[model samples]
Target chain A: MEESLDSYVDKGLVKTYLFTAVIWLCIATTVGFLLSVKFWWPAFLSNIPYLAFPRLQMVHVNGVAFAWLFTAFFGVSYYYVPRLTRQKLFWVKGAWLLYFLWNFIVVAAVIEFLLGNNKGLPYAEIPIWINYIVVVAVVIYAINIFGTIFTRQENQLYVSLWYLMAAIVWSALNYIIGNWIPYYWATGNEGAMLNGFYFHNVVGMMVTPLGLAIAYYVLPIGTDRPIYSHKLSLIGFFALAFIYPFTGAHHYIYSPIPVWVQTIAIVTSVLLIIPVWVVITNFFGTMKGKWTKLTESIPVKFVILGSVFYLLTCFQGPMQSLRSMQKIIHFTDWVVGHAHMALYGAFSLFIFAAIYLMWPIISGKEMDKKLGNWHFWLGFVGFSIMAMVLWAAGLIQGILWIAQVPFLNTVWDIQPYWVIRTVAGAMMVLSFFVLLYNMWKTNKEAASMD
Target chain B: MKRSGNVILIAGFGFFLLGFVVVGLIPWLQPKQSTHTIVNLKGKPEPVNEITGAAAKGRLVYIHEGCWVCHSQFVRPVSGEKQYYGPVAQAGTYNYQLPMLMGKRRIGPDLSDEGGKHTNDWQFAHLYDPNSISPGTIMQPYPWLFHGSSAKPTKRAVELVAYLQTLGTDVAEGTGYKSYWQYKAAQVSAVSTVVSNTPQAVREGMKIYNANCQGCHGIKGGGNGPAAASLKPAPWNFTSGKWMSKYGTTDKDIYNRIAQGVPHTSMPEWATTLKPNQIWEVLYYIKTFSQKKTA
Candidate 1:
């Protein structure tokens, strides 16, 4: 079969990370579902302070960004690096050691947040000490991956490796800027400005590069063609690195942050459409004569589905950064919908495709195709319904607010939409459960065979 | 040499540093706005805006409880927020905070100028059980912030409330409307022009009563509304004539109580929610519950 794919790979380590990622995804989505439900049923778990909305919110955001996506990226990176480099993974033992140590830190950070010992900033809510442990873990991971690249038998670095290296560097820097900088340096609105930078970077640096890595690698292979344009890929990668950092303050537009800085953020945000479309164009170009693969391959369908949402969300992001649009939607559920669309709708879908591709290779067993399709439609339809309701509800709320009506009335008016949001959230959660079932069954069969 | 890897690595890192300086570093270098001193509801200046004492402890409790998550602190100039929340907050108003807690969502109302909007008694009751006063409120009952089964303040709750009370007072606003309302009510409070005890007048009073007072004071003036348990000293039930007279409940006294709110009870000030005539009408409706010849 082609060239034996796994002689140098640590399949067991990849399997462990993938399974861990799915469990954390389940936990995080459940937290998000409860958050939506709590809008109407505030007292459902009111007796427990840890289950309070804010505490649970801390659990939700961090669980997705750190616990879920971070681990999934680890799984994919472990699986992809050796294949791309044509080398055995460097410091395989160290990767396993970091796994348990890193997960322990994540769990401890979550518990500490629930215990009311939190940093109280967006995308950086974990307490400061936990931040140090996280950075050290990343350092070890970087060294291991970099070592593999250094000792590679393949002289030509793949497109995925370019992204892999950038993501490692960007994430380490972005993480420090978000969690650590404020403790020593900034205050008041300055801190908030830094937060806007950190907020976008977590997704921009953490998810975007890694997700596109998987997408770029998987798309051409699934389509049985080379990428559409090498020049386009190069343009997209460098433009993204250059533009993403300047765009975060768009989230905090109209705040106490300086107007010029906000403008800079807005301009850079709109400029992002270039790189975003370039990446999409390259992927679509790769998919040029392989339309039939949509029916033949589940991973191709998911990657394509994720690309559409990625385009919509990235476009929506820049439009929102425009101050006029923000005057209506800022602080509303519209932003919430936009955020969920990016992470859940776009990036998670890309990662799901990777997991689908990787599970069989790593485990030597296949997940049920019917269940995979079920997961796809449920996740796609459920998230679309949820995002639309949040966006519409947010628009209505924003209109009511601008009309100068009572604030409580807006909260009341949106209760019905929240019901829809909760139900759609339930569907998405169920989709993940279907995935969990398929992966678990594969694990069982793989174990029995061994 | 892997020239491509070095280009991506060095340039990617270069972009990261570029962003760090422009977005992160430059903003902190801007001269910070001044620290704002709070003026209490009595129109007295508080000890400079360092936020020490109970209020300072309350600030920590605010963050700890994640109150800042739902309750935003700054008010914007657009969208009638100034009309609604009293003032558009400047950056200096939050100068006391190391990193300001200008939260994103306003699931609750903005607390920009929230000081002295309601009394400590109302704040205590609302914090223990928000639905007690605003039947449709989305706020979760923070009973843990209180004592066992009562609205009595634990140190944290008291500090939290203290911090809340100081919210928008930093900018020398509020009490303008309160004093104006008080003066207007005092002018015509002696006579019951709007509270005629007629069939139509009583019906009008019933409407206002149902809208506002009926939640806490009960449908039959029995102080046994659905939310009555969480309040200390409880809401008043006027079914018994004795309790009505205990407060020297003349027409003027009744108007003053409605406008200023009662102490040690769940009754919030109607200065903002009701007009003077509406309060007088609701007063006449409640008087009918008095089992006395003079009701």
Candidate 2:
């Protein structure tokens, strides 16, 4: 069994995943800073084509969403899946090929977008050829994950395993439906509706589920306690499976989509409150009387804070989906704030926690708690400041626009808000450095343990 | 150990299930009804033809491009709007719209009555290269709409024009169609006449001014319109000497300034927004501003 578990932990795969995560984290954070500066001082990079606001925005979003988060996800999954299942990966070669292919697709997509060959949908702006590459990579991922599960020695699946399996399967299915090839490239004129469907589902099915799966696995393990309620976990999982697909329309509340579609979206979004709150309450309740433990364990701190962000983001998401609320917030920086809170605050933090918790076991070493603490504090403080500033900017912009105060007057009013966002974004950049430092230190310690 | 973990897991799953029902399933099953009513204010009942019409097809293009994110088609009933945009939009104006474009943002102005507001040449120029006709416009030029060629009008431009010309006018009242034809005829007449003995300085200034200022100031220096309307601080009526006085009175002052530009206002610097001789022509035109008469 010891030999088997040892075989399950591949140092090379873990290193590859970690290196990608660190590299992409730096790239994404830098681009994020550049995007914020562009907003604050448009003249700074106004002459450059690739650095223009629109192109920079695409780079920033894709870097964070695809490169940073997915890299982290790959790293964590590579480390934990084998340890949790008590078996070696189905195919190490297959997984390594997936890593290379995934990166290749991301790099090509970024270049295509910079060259102005975009499909023009938010989040789906990558060119069609690049999208096909992503589809190929996803298929490879699905096959590898399923093969690993089928070959596992464990008979009774753990809740973590269930979540991991469900996330992969569901994401694979949703991606195909969301990015329906015929609709996206064929009828370019009506592609917006199809793109909107695909774009929101990417958030709902891909980002949300994957993040939650990692959180569920890491939180219980890091706390040295079993989950508070298995019933609640199942509820959250099934509820997400049933409801997330329809909620994509919420993004179109004031849009030109049919009224019935928006109605479906608003109701689903509001109802999402139940699943989101349930998950929050259950996770926190399990941590009941164990607050001190959280403080002691850096991984616990990251996981708990991530869960808190999840609660905050989902609640804000539902509120923003309401037609009346959308009237005040749609197409404004408010949605940008919401995306950051959901994707970065909740998802990325959870992924980070999963990495920290799993790294010691996978690499056969103990991480320096001091470095972990530094990383956690930086990320927590940085994310909090960034989220707040973005939310404030979005809200102010939304209210002023709706008030019809006057076009030129509104632009003048929001100049200070944009400046504040840039300042807040600086904190996030600092946090990324701290994260890299901690991860690098931990890696060295793990090597020493070997 | 296995038994305990299993029990704990089961309990966790159960709580999640309950939460799902309360939050996810319940919301999905519930009926969502909205109280707000959208009014289409262009003064005509939406024709069945408009519902299944070429305008609807153009609207699909609008959606595909995410145009609604920046440009609202609806004009709200507000004091600033009433004063600036002619009339507030009504619910009837949207009766023909299948999916209404009452967009939520004011990145650009409300475009409810953009029809009959400008000449076809002006619209074509703006669409082909927004910076070519209106220098400070933040709106991305729709080069694709002009077939991705060198800023020439295309069939898509014509179709888009047809859609814009339908905005804000009551076609049922017959005035919308009449005004559209009248505007088209005037554009033809204006294009035919070449001003005789026009100084090179004046000609350059006119080109600069038209490319950078025409959207808001009107092609003829009259403060008429652009497709965007929801400007909170309304666009300046350039025809007024009072407005011109806000800049400066002297011809040289106006020339140097127009060649440069006021900071922070939509007025971009001609060094960037226009060429040097173009700036001089724009300045020459501004010198023609008279306090005694409106354009």
Candidate 3:
């Protein structure tokens, strides 16, 4: 604490994960923009087998969900654990091992996707051998995290630690079940059920809780105030743990999976509102008198904006799970819109906040505020237009479909919307480059200061 | 508070297990047998045939291509999908499929009953370049699946097409194709009737013609629609009246040809897509094109 030389929290490790995330964010968003282009012009970059729509789709998805967001979460975890526990990160060498192993899994998964050697399980398309490596990486990560907590100077565990701990356990179980049982042990109906479980759990249990851990930590820190109610976050934490795993089957409402499972998915999906409501209350309540600070502080502004987006996404989630809504929305770009609001709008924005809040600590210099705001506005405007366009297009497609119009007619109707979506996506794709430039300048300034 | 971390881990694992039981285990353990069928519309239980040979290899090609991401296999009963696609899909219908490409998104139409919807040649042509037979479609072309030309399908293409034809053969081939054939089987021969084209018939025929036939056959009944550019053997110009009397091609013969579809051509079986009345009306509308040639 006396010296400003290195860091007790391992700043080098934190920067590795955070910077890797920014690079992947640029690549992933650009890939995603190309995907939107393919909706209107399927031949765009489609002449090559590697650049085909299906190939790039897997790459774009894993790039965003696992590559960008997952590494960012790891950055937050490494940065927070030492601060929370008041102890140095345990087995520092093991952390670096995890860094290499995890990155290898992601890189390998992308190459396999392009090469058409994928396992053909949508998001779980990484070959089985690579999946095994992923399982190993998570286990090492779990041990490293728990070991630090186990040897902490502080006897009392903070609420963020609780969510972090639970998130890790759930993720370990999630990857094992999601990858193993579906492909190896079963197929057909059972395989599908497990795949569905794995699919939603990747977002729900893994990313949601991990991101919420950072939200709980940083909202108070970013605002320079303590959280609103510690007890409220506890209630939200437990509620999320119990309800999230059951909501997977909502992805397959009218599917041949048993009627009871579908009912359970719908009911549990609605029940998720409790935890979501609790988060909204806790977060907005923390921002009470510091609302003016949000005008100047990028981190506070982004976190608060992300919370509002999270509220919209979670409310829409349960409503769409209902049979009446699912009938229209399922298999449509409406779900794509909803997914964007969750992963990109809510969680990615939260990570953007985390990157800004922690960047000075990692790089030893504050990021440029002007560029940060530019990135923020571009992302917000671009993604907002994209989500709205996709939702309207999906609803129109759904209506025409229900009317028994030829399937091709719906495709024809959405051409204009797809073009608009591509434009909006381009703006979003452009925003990531702004962030990347900011990251580079900030690091350069820090290096010259040293 | 230190021990609370262990408790949280235990409790989290427990909740996940409970979810696993409810969402995954119970349904998997149910006593239901994996039968390969559901009853056809004929009130008879039709046994679903197991895909084998080239179709089996084609199934892998389908998976590798990630076709399931866009094309769903199941046809749900809700949303009046019964009329749109043939037969509400049952669980047993997909029991034999390995990963069960009963996909979620309908970026393309549900392929649950794609079998017999188009002839083998149409499948080859469509797969080679989707925009050829289907104008303005965003489906990616599979030129790699073919050997140099649309006509020269590689082994994988044939296998893929073979698998496509096996999609919903257990039930009726398609919603309209079965009904059209059934209705036509009972209708008396129309070869003797020199009846002129009724105005109502022409109007109805024009609507169906614009919807289905105009993609290949031009609006002016010339073989020059937007999709006609890439088609081999090209669409027949209905407005060219010289061929009808020279070949003694009767009106009845043309009507059957329209339903059955021309072989080795991009003209898909309207029987698979259009009802009998629609075909009859569209035929009358096209006949007016030939009358223009005579005029």
Candidate 4:
């Protein structure tokens, strides 16, 4: 069994997935920077079809979510499943094939976006063909991971495995129901309401579950302590699955979507805080005597920081769902800021922790401490500044609109904040490259020692 | 209860399916209904004011350009949107559209009732180069609309213009097409060829033109202002006697076009931008350029 597991742990595939993720991080964050600049200078690089505001924005979002976040999640899943199951992957060859296929779909979909063959949805903008490909990939992950679990060397299932299972099933269903059904099933308000559910599910169901799974697995390991309460972790998992899916309609709060549906969305969104609190308490409680580990371990610092941002994102999400608050911030830069806080500051930080924790074990080499610190501080500070500026911009724009100020004047007023965002985005991009360099150098040192 | 991976997967799928059924499936399966109407080309009643022909093609162009990304088509009851954009758009307002482009952001004003807010001429010019009309507009110049030069619109430009003019055609609030053409015709045929030519009127006209028209139509009425480079049909040259004679450039004609901008041109309706007295004064100033001989 040990020999079989040794053969199954393919560092080459793991390294490839991480490398692809970092490449996307660099490329997509630069696109994000360019987009922020476009807010201030609408015509800059706009002559190119792909460089235009809307298309470029889509590329940045899709690329970051699929190429950067999901790819890292995929790599971590491969590393994680074996450790939890105490067995090799059910099909290593299939995992390798899925990796290439996933990258191809992401690249092809991005090209399609530039060529204007988009499906016209916000995040599910990938064409129908590419959407099908993603469905196939999700199914493969389910079978492979579940197959390993069935033949596990250990009988006990960890809390992280439950989230992993739920994430996989929900992700597949979310993609199909959100992307496919909306095309033919509905139109007008009904379609918008359905699409809204699909939109939030992409983040709430997929990213949130996978991110929490990583935290549940890594937080204990990083701080060298067992979780405080197994029951709390279980409750957090089920609560999230129940509440997160119903909260999508809150996006269309003031729209023509039936008032009841909007109210349900608001209530479910508030209920989401229960899972958030449970999970946060479990993480912080695990650190009761090991708070000093946060200063000692880079992975612990990232995991702890992610928990704080996660708390902020959940709190802010419920507040924004309120009717009075949605009136002001729904369509403004505040939503943009909130999205970044959740996706980048919270989940991306968790993904970085996974990378840091797993890299040494996989490569058998330690990361450069100085470069890792640079990566953490730069990313944390840059994202915080960008989020704050965008939130402030959103509030100002909302108030000005309510006061009946000319729209163009509001656009001009937000120019300075956008400039600040561009600089912050650049720093975030720089941090990603710093991370890539650290990983590469560590790998090189390992190879030389061998 | 002890749960295995398969059991967890099954439970998760079931939970997600419940939300999917409640929030997604039920709403989608329900019948669509709307009260909006329009007369078809065959003069029959249509359920919805269906967009067809050039207008249909224009909708494709709008999506291809991703115009819906920035401009929402609906207006909410809250946010004082009715005051800004015309009416609070019902769900039915967008029923005719297949993948409704009820966009998310309001980077530009809501285009729900944008069909006839400005004349066709202003729409064309705004499409070509937005700054040519609304100074400081952040909209990019669609030089592609003219296939390069603004001398005349291409076939696609004509189709795009047709689409913009039909955004709110179901409501009586759309640019009252029949009356606008009639009013435009009368203004041209019933105008006096000569201006008042009083020095005071001409001087006041110069000031009005300087403040407004000179940005596009140039100082000295030469149609060569700094912004003229980006304008289509390049602002009308008041100095060209031949062109003036062909179009019957008279005080009443100038006043009419000024008060109600020429359809499909860059010239905006000056009625709100300038007072009636200032429009009359600008007419005298335009006449002086025609009265001059090239030294």
Candidate 5:
């Protein structure tokens, strides 16, 4: 037995990209609970044009950022590139034609953003011919993850393949600077300073270097212990690829460009708190005395609650890039609760702790630990009551629109914090239906005990 | 030191092309501020207007009806939103705009000088039913930009109200409403009847203020009144003490300036012959002519 069969790779394209990332995280938590009940029912289903809340908030922000966090980062880099290149998948039918052409280009971009056929940017709303089908499916997944790291059987190259080869070339150059030069060569405020370097380098170089390369490859293999330093994770991966490409023009601090390019985007967004505190202090110094594997692992308590929400989304992204806190929470709802505390509290709780550490090694069984602690306490108490009612209704609509008060009285005093952020987005859509019913009852109890 | 994948793909695509040549291709290959100035339509200044024909197909039907995702053309000088959306935005105010709706979201408001602020039948009754002309408007109601049960419109609501009457009026041309179209062509002709807060509606609001604001506020509200010597920031005097700190001492800000008139002034709109309690009995007989010029 070739030292146990499971040693090879493409576990059927990592169970079809984690079953299309739990069906686009239940269609992005039912289009983010109908865009948080259309922010306190603004004619809720506005005589349906695909249930408009501006195309269901761009289908809940491209179905939770590119069909559920880029199909759970291509099902955790096709189950850790053949278990860190012991060698296997160089091109198994080019990974089933990149999983049916990346879910038929995200179902033709959620039917071209529900037919409003958009391109209004924010995370590059699809339809520039689906950004050339996501630049030919990120160049056929960077030639099948660099052709299985040049025929390796393991030749020393970890630190999660240097953050998955610089997050697949910084997500194909942040989808051509956030959608082909602001959809064809810039314009006004130089296309809002190149769409603030494609809105914070598409979450700082593509989902914070693929969610810190699956939290530095699932925190030293769920605390057996290792990565405390390796030269401080190679200086927190070249200081987060040179300060997240100059910290996305600090989301254009005080707009009309030039202010020395918003003080070099507020000094590289406060030098991104030095690669978010040296990769969260090397994942809490590799959980020192294997801190009782956080009460016996459910992937080490979702890697210490996603490194404490990636250190509170890099300390509220460098104190909301200064300029007096972007003159009071720039465009309020406190940057929509710091973009859902960095895409659902720090990279969807580190892709739900790398899908509860690769779904019991791709459904061999084990889940139901009280349905993974009620899907991690209903996604950590519904993302802390939806990031404290969108940062206290964006500091009471930026101190009542800076005391001038009357913009419909701060939209009727933030309608009971938008009805408690639609009951914390319906308890984070009932924690993704308790994580798709505990990964369909741990894959039908491991295919009826094989 | 574990490197080679062609030196980490040429230093990660050379720090992604040196952060796209230091924040997006050298400020998109510099050079812009060529020439600028606006005013024209005979008020003079001219030099550029540019956005051609039917306001460039009404800015592609305002980017195909997304209305720049809840308006915002820029303004920001912070907090008084540069006295609520007028100047502030320039980088050659998007010289021939090729796609720069500069919108991020204000939810509503900040149309960066929403040109000639209302009228074209109040932007076609606030785009046909914005809570029937702003009664707690949360916007959304382009009654498919009109026609059936007519208010005519629809050539995409007259090219989206001729691209919102050319936003910020071709870069600061006497900040619009060109003298409220010569005071609504001298209000076609005149008025009389009144009632609502009777004492014969404060004696027909003192004969509707000596037949419409004593020619222009003077029979001693003091703004010299005889068409306030052909206006232009001349009027407002209601015996000074700065008329309730310049036109705002609520009562719904003097019944929304006697039903929305002020836009680039000459006053007019006494809501077509007053009457919301005869404009609250002519704002309680103009606060008793500002308490008879403070006694």
Candidate 6:
């Protein structure tokens, strides 16, 4: 009876994580729709100070990247880390405190940004004070995760542990370096270039690694296959860890930086294809005989599709980093398209898959799998349409811009594309509603399971 | 199995730490060279005149406005940009630029050679209201440049205009417009008869024209301007015969453009920025220069 009750308690923890994931995902998607509209119609929320594109863009990015993805990661880690280690969580209270702190930090940062106190870098828009809160939250998480690992009943650590452990440690270091707080405060206004440098690394070290780590864990587990080769996994991880930090300079290629710095960045960006290809080949190899499983399982479908997008986005990222390509694409909608594909198509889908896979184990019963299927298909179609439209629009914009066509020519050229983006964005909004409905249904079924 | 796993984990961590140290220190220890010496990439670089005291003062205002965020003073060797924006900007061009404003991002065009691009009147009008002339320009309006006096030119706007007119003056050295300001003042005084109908009407017209026409037509009525450098199928040189003949100098045509604006050009409708009567006055002012032989 005690063992049975402990199993139920474990399920309750999973429920908490899943609920948080779904909530943040809906919030992020809704904000994403608002941002999409702002691109075509700047006047949509022109009268409202907080709703302007600059402010809304920062909010949308933080919502999707940090709020939704981090919460979902927390949910997955809580369920899988202890289960894989054959141990109870080292500190449930610490985990709960970390969650609250994370949410509070995000809320405060968004409020400060809306009120016009931002660091003014893309993705690193949150203020200095909010960075402190985030660091504290990460520290708490690191202690809890590490403590659980140290106290595990299982003697042999799993592959998931490797990815998860590295993600936490690296992300913590990334936050410190990316913020460059002491250096920035010391240099004052002259630190803008340095700040840009740090900002690039934040995307490199924090977002990319965390997203890939989650994918590494979820893909193998959902496919019911061990990763195809441990050697390949090690190779991918090490190559990524080594190369990603330096590649941030690619964003600054055309700027007034020293030439060698830009050259170093371009080389590393190209070489990054090695790690990406390794991961892609390994995932495809593992899923080789499991094509039918994708059709049957909503979680597998989202994860596999996400992996495919990850491959496309990383490839395009290196191409865009090329000086000639950047000449046409930088400051245009092409970068926007790349950003959406990376953040929404790749990371968001993987987060959704991880939550779906963990929900039943946490709820101690099966959810209405039919609703999950509906959610998956809606998101899959919506994200694909949105990505394709943006890519089309971006290409049109790039060609016209580089051709030395009149400025008005490029603006007129992209009008039809903007209309398509709006339509695609509407479909994505509908997908969010479907996701909300599915999660709510799952919650109701979990209550009934008791 | 557990013992072997422990050994592997310890070894892995050590290898990772060693890799991190090596990668992090490598760049710092062997830093990239600080500078490069390029050969006469564009032939002997154009001769630069000594920076004037006033131009030096104007450079401060440029930096304060964060103008470097969008406007690149330096043009690259790339064919599309070079052909469109004039000759590629050389390193010698920036010899006198303190904390050089050679920016990234071409939201507007490079201003490497903006001297004698337009008349002082055009510059004044543009600085007052960009939509008044250029219409549909992305440049943020400089309302702060003018004193809030009822539509009259302020001293500050004139100084800023003085600064813009000086860009790319090296090419204009031997021409009658050797000094951009002296040429602009002479042009404004010479064309006083065409615009003498009403100072108030012309002032309102100037406001409308600046906001609408100044980006492509220039701050002055001269054809060359900052934004013109970036435009492909470049903006028409307003002082040229081809421009006047192509767009007729009739009152109706000028009024129609100012009131309704040209479709598919950066020119936007001035109906929002100007009153109907004000738009007519601006048309009258534009027609004054339409019949002129020189800028």
TM-score of every candidate relative to the true structure:
0.88, 0.71, 0.91, 0.85, 0.35, 0.70
Q: On residues B110-194, what C-alpha lDDT tens digit does candidate 2 reach at each position?
A: 6766665555555665666554444444555666667554335566567677677667655324334343223222222111112
Q: What is candidate 4's lDDT per residue for B85-192, written digit by digit as tens?
A: 545666656666766677777777778766655556656666776656545456656666686655467787788788887875554424344332223323333334
Superposed Cα deviation of residue A364, candidate 5 (Å):
2.8
lDDT of 2 by residue, A71-145 (tens): 777777777678777767888888899899988977886776565455445566666667677778877876776
Model 2 CAPRI rating: incorrect
Clash count list over all predictions: 0, 49, 0, 5, 0, 31
Q: Candidate 4 lDDT, tens digit per residue, A1-450?
A: 545554556777787888788888888888888888777777788666666677777789999999999999988888778877777888888888889889999899888878767777667778899988998888888888888878888688999889988898888888888787667756667778878998899899999999998999999889887899999998898899888888898888877667778898999999999999999999999999999999999999999999999999999999999999977876788989999999988899998998898787677799998999999999999999999999999999888777655465567678899899988888898999999999999989998999
Which candidate should be chosen as best, given lDDT against the real structure?
A: 3
The C-alpha stretches of model 4 lying farther than 4 A from their native spots are A1-8, B29-47, B151-155, B173-295
- What 10-residue stretch in candidate 3 chain B is worst by lDDT? B179-188
The best candidate in terms of DockQ: 3
Report DockQ per prediction, comma-separated.
Answer: 0.42, 0.08, 0.52, 0.29, 0.17, 0.09
**What ranking of all candidate models by lDDT puts the best one first?**
3, 1, 4, 5, 2, 6
What TM-score results for chain B in every one of the models?
0.66, 0.48, 0.75, 0.59, 0.28, 0.47
CA lDDT of each prediction against the hidden true structure:
0.80, 0.63, 0.81, 0.78, 0.73, 0.62
List, in the given order, the native-contact fraction of each candidate. Answer: 0.50, 0.04, 0.55, 0.41, 0.42, 0.04
Q: Chain A in model 5: its TM-score?
A: 0.35
- Least lDDT summed over 10 consecutive residues: which range in candidate 2 chain B? B184-193
lDDT per residue as tens, model 6, B94-138:
434433455444445566655555555555555555444445544
lDDT of 6 by residue, A128-197 (tens): 7888888899999988888888887778676667667767776676576556542344121112233444
- Give the CAPRI rating of model 6: incorrect
Rank by TM-score (best first) = 3, 1, 4, 2, 6, 5
